[model samples]
Target chain A: MIKVQNLRKVFRVHKKPPGLSASLKSLFRRDWIEKVAVEGADFTVEEGEIVGLIGANGAGKTTLVKMLSGIIHPSAGEARVLGYNPWEKHDAFRRQISLIMGQKAQLWWDLPGADCFQLLREIYQIPQQQFDHQLNRLTQLLNVGEELNIQIRRLSLGERMKMELIAALLHSPRVVYLDEPTIGLDITTQKAVRDFLLSYRKEESPAMILTSHYMEDIERLCERIIIIREGELIYDGSLRKVIEQYAPYKRLTLHLQNQTLDESSKEIFSKMGEKVQIQSDQVSIQVPRKNVTEVAAELLRKFKIHDLSIDEPEISDTIEILMGGKDLRQE
Target chain B: MFVNLAVQLVVLWALWTAVFAESGKELVGEWDLTGILSYGVMVFLTGRVVRGGDLQMAVASEIYDGSLSRYLLYPLNYGVTKYAQQLGNVFPNILQSIVMAACILPFMGSSSSVDLHVTGLLMCMPSLILAHLLFYIMGLLPQLVAFWADNVWSLSVLMRFITMLLGGATIPLSLFPEWSQGALAILPFRYLFEFPTLVILGKVSVNDWLTGLLTCAVWCVVMSLLVIPVWRRGNLRYTGVGI
Candidate 1:
């Protein structure tokens, strides 16, 4: 449903120092800086797939989404959404695509969501029956049937976001670009949104690219993930593989019944794992994933332990490591 | 806003009355005090229709805050959608103009010169709508500068002032010296403001009506065509950020 090759965008922005003097000086000689927003990005998404785009702020995630949605033209490279060049913005291409932004609303703020949907119905030239059916289905799924009559600005952010989703999907677009759909939503609302997208995928199966920083949003919604950092795609694969590769160590923590630990016990744990820390009543160790079980068994047999736990590194921590220029994959 | 306009009319009525009295002339620039006062009332009425606040900050703010992404994604022309949204503001303002003309036109001038032309009034409707379109595009052209500049408020204000003066909303174009009137007449401003008022007041002959409509229509076509290129180039640089 989507094909992108060497998709690049360079933004030429004026650079100026702050103050009235710099403002006046810029009148004659302004400095220009070219920042590569997306650097030779290459990826494709298939029908019925939800690909999560992961990046910290200013990491070009949104830029990639924008270029694919045809909202902004790329300075270089090519992208075809649903077999049409997205940047060309053909009318048929636009009709088949939808962009739902969590921070910005697609519906008119002063008007009711229902009224905005009516306008969208006309804009897309949807059949009356299809428009009515989709409106009913989406509003019912989002459970915003009652709130549709109220002015959009009067609703809460979560409610407004639900309305935005309905608006974007009113015509059953074939390709969807969702940028930070769960950014400001509450936990319950986020879950609701994620669940809705899951069900929607089951029903419509449109190729989707969801860009978000929320780990849960990515974990619960996207099976495949692409990690972007510094305007480049560093990793793209299954989330489990990412966790297995980037997070190679398992954290073994033990709560001890004894207030003191012997030197021999410390030496034994130090031999088993790196970064072993022995406190008064507890010991925590970062052990290799393959040997975590053996180390834990040894510790349990030797120590008078009150509690024991083993946890793999979090996906967020792994992403942070990648973003900070450490590549555990090399090892 | 209505109250502010009302206050300005009262103050201008007294000021113009004094000006004609002090000058000790029956007509200033070929318009008697009563004619100028009637023109002032028409200015307010036409101003309501042509200068509806709906289009004022909408395009500029969207360009700045990246709210335009909503429009960009939809399968619709942004310019047409913007104009359709402003139509809601126009209908009410048009009704208000009619009500004010009916209630206040007689009081502005009791002279026979305030003659209402039934045919001219009917003919003004299409041209009035054309003027509204022309004004909308002109105002929007400068606001699109926000694609590069941070704010276009100063340009918007400057456009408002220039339109008010040259369109005869602030001062009648007849009052301008004869040499400048030729250039002023060639501009689209007068067709937007004063032409409709002149048509209703029976000051326009059939030939003038045809000329005014043609000028307004031609300007609308030219300016509407101008928006396509400007919007296309501007979209090339649009970052679609901030939202």
Candidate 2:
């Protein structure tokens, strides 16, 4: 339900110099710089799909979300969310979409969370029955029923974030932009939030774009992933495809009872894999995916192996290598 | 709050009383010593009723910090929402101002110049409401520039001084020269305080009240229209940082 084509945003910012003299001089003759926050971003999200937008810090992930949610206008290109240009900010389109920022608390600090929801109810003009049903179901899903009456500022960060989610979903928006929704939460709370999102996505079937630094969140929630780097979309495809394409090697950790640390055996292990590290009783190596089992069997037969493990490399490390301009594909 | 208001009223009474004595005249323009005293009381109460808090700071800081992001996503008019927030801040002061006015009116009401009529007060409410809106937009327009500029706090501070002088919060507008009064009557500032003060004093004819209300209403429309473009252009400049 979202289509974007070369969507771009450029910000004109004034440049100033340091020192008292330069500061005074800048008042008379100022310099200007145009910053491209989002450069020619191209992607589309379909209904009932969750797209994980992955990037490091300052990668314009939030900027793209802001433009799509109609919080800010794009400097160029076109975007249509739910068949309406988001920049035009049609009320009908706004009612159909929600943007949740983890770093920002959108509810009133002094008011109870329920009061904030009531205010949103009036703003969106949701029918009374729908509002009540949604509120009950969302609060139940998030397990924040008793916390709703407490002032938002008094609640813990995790509790407050749950209230924020309920506030965003009360109108049952057709599109959702979750920007670091699990940020700053404990592991248990993060899992709770991710699980709640999974349930909500299943029931509501809204097109979702989740931007987060946490790799576990992406691995759990998204099948299709888009990677952004320095305001440009670098990779966009199925999560498994990207992993398989970028990381074609698996790691082997072996423990042997009679393995020797001699140079002759080290040379043999090196020929079979990459980055071979050998110990008196253990050895670890990076082996190509197809050769892992063969290498493990060879080591077992040759050295009285006690244990072995074959595992994929961490996807986050592979992404970091990709972002650093390294070739991840061996072929 | 009550004690502070009481002390400020005493100070205003002393300053105006001394000015009348130093002038060696029983009357100065349309306001006698007792009349200016009543004006002081009105000013004391109306100032709170008008400038309830630092509205410009509230608007500017929210924009600068990107708190405006969430509101922009909502299916509601942002301007009306902000205006409602400003009104909410001032609503308590309105109640206090009424109570304070009732207490001080007993002392100021014994003079011939002190005229309190239900008709006058009824007429004054609409003008006061219009003036409140006009002044609110005045403050809000400058702060919307925060979307571009780094800071706009000084603009609101400057507006306060200009309103105090032109709107006649410190001195009665009747004291201005006739030529200046004619122009000031048409300006939006006079309607903010001077026109409402005149209406409360039962000094204006029905025609004058209607004309004043119409002028204030027109300025409200003109300024509210101006907000649309300024807000539109500024919203594009907003980066929604810090969120």
Candidate 3:
């Protein structure tokens, strides 16, 4: 369980201009600007709930997680994970929760994942039997049994992420904070990670707060979604509700029998929908949920329809809209 | 520490033997086989006790990686953890220094003046321990600069070089000018190496010993107070960049 009240994190960043002269000037008189990374963000997560913290880049998702996990203190407000003040970092608090950042690894790079796992086992003070059981279960779930013995640096990104998950989960902490857990993984590996989280959630019922740009990760593993923008919480509710609120229009694609729809006909359909676009033999339109049946009937009667399909806007598109058209393109 | 000392000892022996052969059987000063071997022990111990690489690396890394937030979150004192790590590093460095001394011992005979008084040796232990602590803290203070500065490599290098020079790891402080010696005497650097070496060599007066020990204590306190405020303010300004 987690509770956050008006969480705020402000960062003072040094500002310097380019060029040798500016650099030299900065050496004598440095300048700094205060930026709010997370501002008055508030949310609560119940035990056993897997909540996705979604945002565009610079949305303060990681900042929020860091505060909750005791990695960094908040600038103001309060956060408690499992009734423990995170920033206080009591040993008991740390023992009850784990934070895993995908981009930044906790593994010993040159050593085998096994060695890192052993070291963590000692650090977490897990019993030998329990450690073995957890390791076996995690490795099997992540399908990384064969890769554990090899040095972490030798493993692929996906393999390394799998081991990272195992290392973080070995202690079986009740609260898991995962930041971009599935980033950079291939589809299959992403699915594997998703499935592992799903199963782990079902078994342990640990409270999980996952932050990622990948909508598929949220869709597969998180029923609840928290959307933040520019350090403020914009949306917090069911994932489906978030989709409905931001992207209410349903997309309908009608495949025609080699017939090009005229402008007037496209306009006719457009009159019944929000956006209408016609290609060589297909007509794609975004219609409101209430007008879908009417729009479909109109299209069926007006066009030489061969095949038809309807799709709700993707969660990714909904999130993009929620963030006010901020770019989510991964580099 | 043992491995490192062994390597240093082997290198010292080879260098000393080459120097001896080049000198045509004539040894330097009263530092014959015995004094030369004692010098090796002194150098090795000074080098080990003045070790700053680990502390520098740890601080630099935590600053660079933004993992220092992890340390800041803990309830335990950061100073304690830093000292613990420095203590851990001392084991290996001391072991290595001893091995280096052993290698030189075979080439140099035992010295008649190499006497260890029980009280002096006992006092020397705590003094050296305090000196090592002071050196570690002094080395660490520069690393805290990494929080504000982009990179600490130059600063760390400068600190190491100063420690080697002023701490008398490479040259004895006694060889310096009286004014310079007096300045070094009050500084923590001299306490890190020169004080302990003098104590071991039975060259320290009781009053000088007390002054050196008090100087080291004052430095430890001063550095801690100075660095903690800087570290706290730096953390406030910390962006946790590149996360």
TM-score of 1: 0.92
Residue A191, model 1: lDDT of 91
lDDT of 1 by residue, B1-243 (tens): 467668878887888889889999888886777788887887778778877645887898998888998788888888988898788778888887787778776666465455566886798787778888889999889999988888899998999889888998877899889999899999989998889888776788889899889989999989978987998999998998721
Give one digit per residue, the lDDT tens place, for model 2 in A1-331: 9999998888777788779988899878989998777889988999999999988787788989999999888889999899999978899999999999999999999999999999999999999999999999999999999998999999999999999999999999999999999999999999999999999999999999999999999999999988887777888889887767888699999888765678787888899899888767888999998898898889888777788898888888778766666533343
> Which wins on TM-score, candidate 2 or candidate 3?
2
The whole-model lDDT of each prediction reads 0.86, 0.86, 0.79
- Clashing residue pairs for model 2: none
Q: List the residue pairs that clash in candidate 1.
A: none
DockQ of each: 0.58, 0.69, 0.29
Taking all chains together, each candidate's TM-score versus the true structure is 0.92, 0.95, 0.83
Q: Rank the candidates by DockQ, best first.
A: 2, 1, 3
Question: What ordering of candidates by lDDT runs from best to worst?
Answer: 1, 2, 3
Scored by TM against the true chain B, the candidates give 0.94, 0.92, 0.79
Highest TM-score: give the candidate number: 2
lDDT-best of 1 and 3: 1
| Candidate 3 pairs with clashing backbones | B1-B92, B1-B93, B1-B96, B2-B95, B2-B96, B5-B96, B5-B97, B9-B100
Task: Indicate which candidate wins on DockQ.
Answer: 2
lDDT of 3 by residue, A1-331 (tens): 8999999988877799899999999989989897788999888999899999988788889989888887767889988788999876688888778878888777779899999899777677899999999999999888889998899999999999999899888889999999898889999999989999999999999999999888889888999998888888888899988666567689999889988667787678768887778777877888888788887887889878899998888888778887885433221
